[model samples]
Target chain A: MGESLRIYAKLVGAQGRAQASYRTSFWLDLIGSSIIVGADLIAVLVIFSRVPALGGFSISQTLVFFGIALTAFSIADLVVGNIERMRNYVRMGTLDAMLIRPLGVLPQLLANDVGFRRAGRVVYAGAVYVVALSYADIDWTPGRVVLVVSAPLFGAVFFAAFFVATATVAIWWVESGELANALTYGGRDLTSYPISIYGGWFRRMFAFGLGFAFVAYYPGLALLGDPDPLGGPAWLGWASPLVGIAASGVAALIWRTGVRHYRSTGS
Target chain B: MGLVTATTDRVTIRNFAEFASLIGAIAASGFRRFWTYRQATVAALATNTMFGFLRTYVMLAMAALTPVVAGYTGPQLAAYVWTGQGLLGVVMLWGYADLADRIRSGDVVTDLLRPIHPVLNYLAVDLGRAAHGMIFRFLPPVAVGVIVFDMYLPQDLSTYPLFAISVLLAVIVCFACRYLVNASAFWLLDHRGVVMVWLFVSGLFGGLYFPIRFLPQWAALLIWLGTPGPSMLQAPMDIFVERDPFRVQLAIVGVQVFWAVLMLWACHVVQRRAERKMVIQGG
Candidate 1:
């Protein structure tokens, strides 16, 4: 395990150096990536303008939802953004390059690019979260404070798992990148708003079928002290960290299955 | 003297024929190139269609909250969401770096050294791409939309021609701005950063998320400063919805025309400077 970590570190360092090689481009991408905030802003503003609240949460509360979602996704993007490139590697038969390496394919794949460029999104999300924290109007409690502080870590791991699982599926069918996007990007969009705003089928599919709601929604409910409009217990929000662990486990299992299948098929 | 004039006239006619054929070949090739990526086109269409569903619902919900939110009713909002996706492909803004790659590889020198204009070449290709996208990528989302919600066709007979003109002008404006972005490759080591900045701001100011009307009033006003942000994707979609009066539609189209001309002029100026300062350092 230590050896695998060391190898991962080395690969990450190489990618970091390669990215840092272009100083201006790196900075530009970091700042430019934050522009997605505009889209989010538009959604929030347009929805709230007609009404003061959505799904019993105020505009500031929805902003917190977006902030938490953005923070976690940005952290995931920084570490495992290269998972999105798995389609190319699989289609081009370049997965063999990593397979031939002495390192475990998972570690190498996880460390593939370690997108430093996403630093912009991280900083941007952090700033937005700070704004949300001030505006949410929630009472301060020790346990809640802990969850708020550590929310990003849980979010990062949960989303990293999502990205890995998405990439794993690419090994079988490379053309399903858009479908994968419908999950990751769609999930991000889903979680960034009030859960009750979605249709019944969508809410059920995300909560029970894909299990994306555990990654953010229930935990956000706990943080906000709001009851789950979908009839889940509000106390289930404390499971944020647990959800991260479960996501990691599921991702690991999916990845192992995909790798085994690839070895057997040699495709 | 008569013989000289006759020969000159013959040569001029032949040159015109050659130029027209060149543009035709480039445009045709551009159209055919997209066919090779049928999977990508299908995937993009699927994604757009899904987003249309999600966005329409959101807009409808917003309308429920307030009877007339952002000058759109429920059915109009559905039509807006679906048609907006199609318009996105037709205008088709992206951050590509063909010129940067050429410049980096020292191939741009030869490209510039060609007798024909480079910006015009790219514009021709883009026109062909827009045509292809309109056929395959644009209409499918709207087709999917019809089943989900009733569409709003404008009561005015002239809105169709006006909308078509608005769309054509917007595509020109989009391509022109992109040309200027690509032109930056001549001076900067990494113009990709600039392209990202362009995309970032454009995604917001271009009114992709919602109409520019929804922006904080200050941002809405500031959207028109130096760049032609709204003219790209927003103007055409807004025109199709017929949210504005005839005079307002005319004004919006006028703005699009102005931006298209301004961006094209900037491309010409930048190319001239880039050629003057041409330096081929390494491959």
Candidate 2:
């Protein structure tokens, strides 16, 4: 395990060097991505102010939600920046090199490109969360603080699992790249919102089927000291991280199956 | 001479068959490509989905203040948010990234040498991707929206024709605007900064994140006429919601034609100037 981690570190270092090599393009991308997401967030805040309160939540509460979701997303992008390049690796036949490396293949793949572009997102999210903390009415408890930090970790694991699952299918088929994007990108798009607004059945699918609700919505409910937006049991919020872990496990199993299949297929 | 003509005809047929077969192959390959990188696909989808979640929460929080704004309910608002997010992958006709890369790599010259008109080829490629993207990106969100919220699909059958026309117009206008932005690369060389400004301005004027109707009346009117964002998105949404066939049809087709003609003229002017500039720079 330690050897695997060391290998992962070295791979990550190489990717970081690659990004540093193109300083201008890297900075431009980082700024551009940040501006795009920042604009979206500001637009929401502006529009929300025009209305009384969105979906029965106060401005303060909404701010907290955004803060939490953005924080999780930034961290996810930061860690899995390299994994997102699975398609390019597959198309370029670079995955073969990683497979030949002495370490576990997944770690090398995961560490290949830690996206510094997401640094902008992480900075912005951290700022928003700080601002939210200053204003939000939630009780200040050790448990709450732990949940805030850990929420993003679980969110990252859950999302990374989604990424791995999508890429594993590449072992069998090349065109699966676009199809896999539907799940990962589609899930990200769906989860950024308050899950309750999507209606009960949609929430149920995320909660029970895809298991994304655990990372954001249910935990969000627990943080708010409120019932689940989709009428789920209140206790599920505390247990939501387990769902994230389980999703990761399922992704790993699928990945193993896909890798075995790949070995057999000789692609 | 007769034999030569017959052989030429045969060659043309064979080339057409090859082209058709290539397209089919790419389509088939796209599916497997997506399946293979399934987790990465999920990550991309999750990125979009996460945005949807944040926007929905914001919209829901806003709906608490008012029930109806511009004739849309809370669920309808949520539908628009998710649908627009879905459309991002579809309507990505002209990404500034490509323009920057092409310019930096000096590949724009080769693009000019293509026999079939560079602009048309670009449009064709974009349309193909948009066609595929519209299916995969949108179907899930729309389906989820329908099953979850029962958001209204057009009830008036006649409105479907109007929607189709509006969508076609939207596509043309969007493509033209993209070309205009890309053409800037010829002059700017490094269009990164300029494209950023353009995107920021368009997002505001285009009703990308929120409908222009939410803007104050005078500001919204200015946006409607000039920015071309409403033409790309809001007009279609209007058709879906109001089904005001006469006004909707007129608005879509008329504006699309105007933008297409205007943009083509701009492109012609730019093309001449850019050719001269490139010769001077030995680009």
Candidate 3:
């Protein structure tokens, strides 16, 4: 395992260095990527401008949700987001090359093109998360403090699982990127706010059916010491780590099945 | 004298007829070219519709707090979100880099060699793409909104034609804005930074994430008067929802017209200057 980790680090390090070689272009991309987080933050602020609270949470409370979601999504996107390019690999017959390598296919693909540019999102969102925590009224306990520190990490795992699982679908369907985006990015957008703002089947499907509620909503509730407005159990807020592990298991199984099922383009 | 005047008129008419046919042919080709990407169209439609639901819920939540926020009631906000989602594809606020690519590769010279002006040629093609988007991409989310929510619909009969005109001007203005950004490649040789800035500015100020009316009145007025951003999406959406009074709607359309003309003129000047520089890379 140590050897594998070292090899993966070397591979990803090479690519990162190559990208950073273009200092001006790399910095521009980094700055440009951060603007996406800025835009999303502004959207949240605009909605809060007219109303004191959204879905029974104050602006600072909602910012906690937003910060967690954005930070987690950014970390996931920075790490394994390039896995979505599985379609390109399958289409261009590059998966065949990766299959012959000693490294695990998932690790090799994860290291294929690490998007260091997305690091800006992590920094930006992390700053926002810090500021939000300062402003939000929280009853700090050992458990609450632990959850605050670990929630985004667990949320990252859940979202990373989402990226891998959805990307596995591209092995069968090459043009499924945007459709996958509907779930992956859609889930991020959904979790950025209190799920109570949504109603009917949409809320149930995305929040409970897909396990997105555990990413930020329940955790935010745990942090803010509020019960779920929809009457979900209070313990649900602490279930993020468990949900993340379960999601990772499911994603790994899906990825294994997909890799076995892949038939190359045979060009 | 009468005979000479009639002959000149006939010559001008013949030239106009030929130009019209040229534009029609280019636009038809653009429509057919985009139609070939069947999977992409479907995938984009699905994504757009999903975002429509997400945005609509957020807007509805805001409206629940107050009867109206930023002069938009619940149904009006719903209408704005759905139509803005639909028009997102039609106006195409970003991701068009074909001109920049051609400029970088030195293939844009071929465009200058063509008989028609490059601006007009590309504009025709974009109009064709917008027409295709209107049918395929614009209608589905709107149809979903109508079915799922209590959306605002215009009661006035004339609003239909007025909205159409507003949308058309918006397309032209947006195409001109993108053209200027792409044409920067003639000088920089790689205008990716420009494209990135364009994406950020246009999406934020262009009212894609949320309505510009949601901003402070002074800021909104400045964007309206100074930039072509809001004229691209917000004006048409407000017109479609009848968010403003009739005179204000007319004024909105009028501002769109001014921006459209000014932008097109800017594109013309930029293209002329670019032709003079004519730096062909990678010979």
Candidate 4:
């Protein structure tokens, strides 16, 4: 484990230096991503400006979900996004080289192109989160504090699992980018709003079927100490962190199966 | 008329006609380029369809909050979402940094040396792409929307012609705005940043998000961003929903036309200036 950690640090350090070489591009990327967050924030602000609430949640409350979702997704994207390149690597027959490496295939891929450009999203998400907490009007309690603090941590795990599992799917179907987007980008967009606002089928598919609801919505309810407006116990919100663990386990199994399939087929 | 002057006049008319035909050919080629990309168009259509449903729900949900928010009735809001999805690709209302890439690769010099006006040629290509987008990208999404959401259309035959005219103008304005964004690459060198910002704000001001009218605070500000931004997607769309009176809708088209002219003029000026300052970087 110590050796693995050292290798990762070295790889990331090298990658960071390369990225730092393009000073202007680096700044532009940061600002470019921040603009996306800015646009979403504007949409939310505009909608709330006309409506008192959406799905029985106030604008401030909605921000808590948005904040958690964005931050968590940002964390997941910055790290596991490299895994998505597995498609191209596989197609180019580069996996043969990776398979020969003494270090694990997952770590090498994870450390291949680590970048800080996602910090742009982090900046905006952090800002929105801070603003949300300020206006959240929640009673201060230790349990709530811990939940709020850990929300992004759990959400990141949940999202990272989504990315890894989706990337694993790329081993079988190289054209899985769009299908994968249904969970990654699509799921992120879905989580930005209160799930109760969505229709019954839409709610069922994303919330319960995919378990993405654990990433932000359920966790958000837990932090707010609010009941689930979608006819479920409010405490269902606390299940996200556990769901994140479960997702990671499933993602691992899928990744192993994919690797085994690749080796057996020797493609 | 003198023999030389008469000959010159004849030559000038012939040249103008030839140029028009050249542009038409380029436009056709542009159309074919988009049509050829069958998979990309389908993939993009799928994404747009997905967003169409999401936005429809979001818009209707917002409309449900108030019987009317910013003069958009629930049906009107639904119309806006579905039609916006159709027009999204048709307008290509996003940053186009192709000129920046050309500049980076030194290919822009070839364009500069061409006898044709660079802006006009690019406009031809874009118009062709827009036509292709309308046929392939716009129709599929709208058909789905009509089936699923009961999207609105004008009852009057007159409205169709006017809407068509508005859509054409919007396409022109969209092209001009994108051209201008690309032109800035000559000066900025790193045009992606500029293009990114343009695309990000255009959706807000361009009515890809909620209607600009919903943004009372920002409506004046958006209008002040000058003509092309609002004239492109937002105005044509406002006309589509029949949210405005006929004359008012005609006036929106008028805004689009006026901006299209101004923006086209602006593109020519930028191309001329870029040629003057021709600095080739990292070919």
Candidate 5:
């Protein structure tokens, strides 16, 4: 495991160096990515400007929700986001090249382009999360403290799992990139607000069935010590890490099944 | 000098009909090119429809708290979200960098050598793409919205023609904005930075995320008058939803026309300047 970690670090470091080699472009991209985070924040602010509350959550509480969702999504984007490029790898016969290498396909693909620029999103979202936490009026408790720290981590893991599992569909369906985006990016947008804003089966399917609620909503509710407006179980907030694990398990299985079935394009 | 003037004038008059045909052909080819990607259209339709649902729900929830927010009722907001989703592709707020790619690869030289102006060529093609998007990408989400939500439809008979005009001008204004961003490749070599900034500006100010009218009146007025952002998405949507009175709707379309002309003029100026200072990178 140590040896594998070292190898993966080396590969990622190489990608980081390559990207940083273009200093101006790298800085521009970093700033540009942070600006995207700003846009999302501004959208939340604009909505709140019109209405005092969104689905029972105040602006500050929604900020906490947005920050968590953004941080997790951005971190996932920085790490395994390029997994969505599976279609291109398949199209260009790069997967066949990876198959010949000793390294695992998933690790190689993850480290292929580290997207250090996306780190700007992490930094920006982290600042938002911290600022929102200060204003969120949470009661101090050890469990809550642990939840604050673990929420983003587990949320990142959950989002990364979504990325991988959705990207795996490219193995069977090459033109599935947009469909995957509908889930991953779409899922991020869905969780950025209070889940109570959505009603009926749409809310249930995404929040509970797909486990996006654990990413931000329940966690935010737990931090605020507010009962779920939708009347979900109280323990649901702490269930993020568990959901993260289950999602990872499902994603890994899907990825393995895809790789096994992958028939590379014949050059 | 008199003979030269006469010859130039005659040539201009002669080429007018030919240029119109050329633009039509280019636009048709653009339409056909996008139409070939049937699967892509379907996938994009699915994605747009999904976001439409998410956005519509949020708008409805906000409206539930107040009967109206920022002059928009729940039904009006729903119309805004659904039509915005449909117009998302029609106006194409982002993800068009083909011109930049060609510029980087030095293939833009061919564009310059062509008798037609590059701005006009690309504008024609974009219009064609918008035409295709109108039929495919614009309809599905909107159809779904009408079925699923209480969408506001304009009651006035003349609103249809006015909205269509607004949308056409929107496509032109958006095309010009994107053209200017892509044209920056002439100077920047890699215009990804410009593209990124464009995405941020257009997504936020172009009213893709939410209605600009939701802002304080002064801020919305500033965005509407100072930038082409509202002309791209918000104007047509407001017109469609009849968010304002009939005269105000007419004024909105008027603003779109103003921006469309101004932006196209800016594109022409930028293209001229870029051509004068053209330096092929990797020669």
Candidate 6:
């Protein structure tokens, strides 16, 4: 484990240096990414102006949901940047280098790429989160604050799981990973808004057995003291992070299966 | 005149069984190439579901304040969101990056020299990918929308044909827009920055994230008249959902035809100019 951790650190360090080489491109991407977050935020603000409340939740309350979701997504992006770029590694046959290493394949894969550019997103998510909290009724209770602050930890797990699951498919079809990108990147963009605005089965699937509802909706309900829009018991909201953890765990299992399939198929 | 020639050739080919068979065979191979990426299909479906969920919630929340916000009810809004998300998978094209890569790698020369038409081949691959997305990426979300929201379907069954035509035109318009943007890479080293700006603009104007109806009157009108984004997703969604068969169909196909002619013409001029520039620059 220690050897793997060391290798992981070194891999990420190298990626950071390499990315830093393109300083102008890096900053341009940063500005562009921040603008994306800003644009979404603007959209939400526009919607709120026209309507008094969203499903009994005020704009301030909705902002909390966005804040937590955005922070979680940003952190997830930071950690899973390497795993998500697995398509490139697979296509380039760079997976062979990791396979030959003494460390486990997952760690090397997880540590291979570091996106310094995503730091801009992280900062933006944080800044927006802080601004949202300042205006929100967020109770000053220690436990409440802790729950709110820790939302992203689990959110990251879930999102990274989604990434891993998508990346694992690279074993079968390296070029088609853009479909996964359309999902992950697009999904992140969608989550900033209130989940209730989505179509029906999509909401039910994510909220229930699929476990994505835990990412923001359920947690936000608990944090904000809002009732379940789906008419379920209130306790489910507090337990949404578990959904993220479970999702990541499931993704890890799927990744292992995908690897086995890849080895056997020689794809 | 060019379209007439193209249509006549297509009619002639369709009239011949052997030619149709060959086209079918080539299309099948193309389908197989894309279907092999089954994992991507599943992942994209999952992600689309998640996006659909969020949008549904936002719209539902809005409806809670008022039963009908804009022209759509809560359920209709749900349908709109799911349909829009699903459409992104089917209609959105990565043409710019693909074109940029070809140009930067100097593979455009080979593409230009191919015995078959480069544009036709690209269109074939795009259609195959769109079919795959429509099945794997689109149908799932739409199906889920039906079950969850009890969403309404097209009331007039006859309108379905027009919906199909509108969808096809929407896809064509989307492709033309992407192709035109990508052709810029022939001169520029990197079109990604410009493409991102274009995509962001489309999200606002094209009604990808939210319908243009929600935009202020003047802004929405400007988007409709100035950019091709609304014709791609918004107009089709409106036609299919609102059952305004005549107007939506006309808007979609009309704009698509306009853009297709414009883009093909632009491509011709740009290709000529690019060739001259390349010759002078020794590229």
| Candidate number of the best TM-score | 5
Better of 2 and 6 by lDDT: 6
**lDDT (10s digit) by residue, model 6, range B157-268:** 7557876666666676776677667778876666656676776776776786667777777877788777777877777677667634466557656775676566656666
List the RMSD of every prediction in angstroms.
4.9, 7.1, 5.1, 5.0, 3.4, 5.8
Residue-by-residue lDDT tens digits, candidate 4, B151-242: 77766677788888888888888888887787787777677677777878778778787777767756644573564667888776788788
Assess every candidate by TM-score. 0.89, 0.77, 0.95, 0.89, 0.96, 0.80
Lowest lDDT 10-mer window, candidate 5 chain A?
A170-179
Clashing pairs in 3: none
Q: What is the per-residue lDDT of model 6 for residues A1-267, given as tens digits with 9 covering 90 to 100?
A: 777677688888998888788777777777776676676887787787669776666889888888878888888887775677777777787787777878778877766666677788888998988888888876676767777777767877778888788778777877565667655666565556556555566556544656666777777777777787667677776685677777878898999888767642233
Q: lDDT score, residue A55, model 4?
A: 77
Compose the digit string of candidate 3's lDDT tens values, residues B1-283.
1222111221132477888998999999889988987887888888888889999999999898998989999999999999988998899886788898897776776786576788998999999999998898789889999999999988899899999999999999999999999998878855767888888889888888889989999998999899999999889999998888899999999999999999999999998777666633222
DockQ in order: 0.53, 0.18, 0.64, 0.45, 0.78, 0.32
Ranking 1 against 5 by lDDT, winner: 5
Q: TM-score of the B chain in model 6? A: 0.84
What is residue A39's positional error in candidate 6, in angstroms? Answer: 4.6
Summing lDDT over every window of 10 consecutive residues in candidate 1 chain B, give the lowest-scoring window.
B1-10
Off by over 4 Å in 1: A35-39, A42-50, A175-179, A239-246, A263-267, B1-21, B113-115, B150-155, B216-226, B279-283
Q: Model 6 chain B, poorest ten-residue lDDT window?
A: B1-10
Taken over the whole model, the C-alpha lDDT of each candidate is 0.76, 0.65, 0.88, 0.78, 0.88, 0.71
TM-score of chain A of each: 0.92, 0.87, 0.97, 0.94, 0.97, 0.89
- Poorly placed runs, candidate 4 (over 4 Å): A82-100, A167-182, A253-267, B1-17, B221-227, B279-283
Which residue runs does candidate 6 get wrong by more than 4 Å? A1-7, A87-93, A169-205, A208-214, A217-267, B1-50, B94-96, B114-144, B243-256
Which tens-of-lDDT digit does each residue in A102-192 have in candidate 1?
Answer: 8778777768868888888888888888888788887878988988877777878888888888888777876764656666676677677
Cα lDDT for residue A51, candidate 5 = 86
What's the residue-level lDDT of B82 in candidate 6? Answer: 85
- Ten-residue segment with the worst summed lDDT in candidate 4 chain B? B1-10
Candidate order by TM-score, highest to lowest?
A: 5, 3, 4, 1, 6, 2
Candidate 4, residues A150-192, lDDT tens digits: the string is 8888888989998899888767865444556657776777788
